[model samples]
Target: MLDWTTVLVIVLMAASTYATRVVGFVVLRDRTLSPRMQAIMQNVPGCVLISVIAPAFVSSRPADLLGLAVTLAAAMRLSLLPTVVIGVVATGLLRHFVG
Candidate 1:
């Protein structure tokens, strides 16, 4: 039931994503990272996390905002699993009762 253009687009997207990941690995395989490069790499995870979280927090509704707040507090306390649990439960409960 799929059209040719749609299928081609999907295939190209998958291939592009795969190629990007593979290229990163190939490019870094034999390289010794300099101090600046190492520092950049060290910040990558935090940067990626902030990029994902920032938009969600900014665009979320009040209930989701509450859940995000709870999650952030738990995360600050270094309780990752509890943060995730609280976020999920708070969001689910709010959506169920309010929305």
Candidate 2:
């Protein structure tokens, strides 16, 4: 069942992604970002997270929408780690029980 070619491609993709991150750090090591740009960089991860889950907002599945609601509520009141944990658990339970 294991495809060696697919595995190789995945490994290469992972390596390339990691390489890019390292390269970016190495290139910017001596440079200081402007305060505004630093603030923007800090929000990039959250923006990426929202973009990833944006489709769930319009999903027809009750589990998806409810999970997103629970995630939003958790995000509002909790720190990132706890919010992520609560969201994952809530979504998994909702999907398993409701689907």
Q: Write candidate 2's Cα lDDT for 1-99 as tens digits.
A: 999999999999999989988997898899999999899978876886788678998899999889999999999998777877887889899999997
C-alpha local distance difference test of each model: 0.74, 0.88
**Candidate 2 Cα misplacement greater than 4 A, ranges:** 1-17
Q: At residue 26, give the lDDT of candidate 1.
A: 97
Clashing pairs in 2: none
Q: Write the per-residue lDDT of candidate 1 for residues 1-99, one digit (tens) a residue.
A: 879999999999999979987998899989999999989977775575556456657854777677677667766886445656776787678767766
Clashing pairs in 1: none
TM-score top scorer = 2
Question: For candidate 1, what is the lDDT?
Answer: 0.74
Error of 2 at 54 (Å): 0.4
TM-score of each: 0.55, 0.78
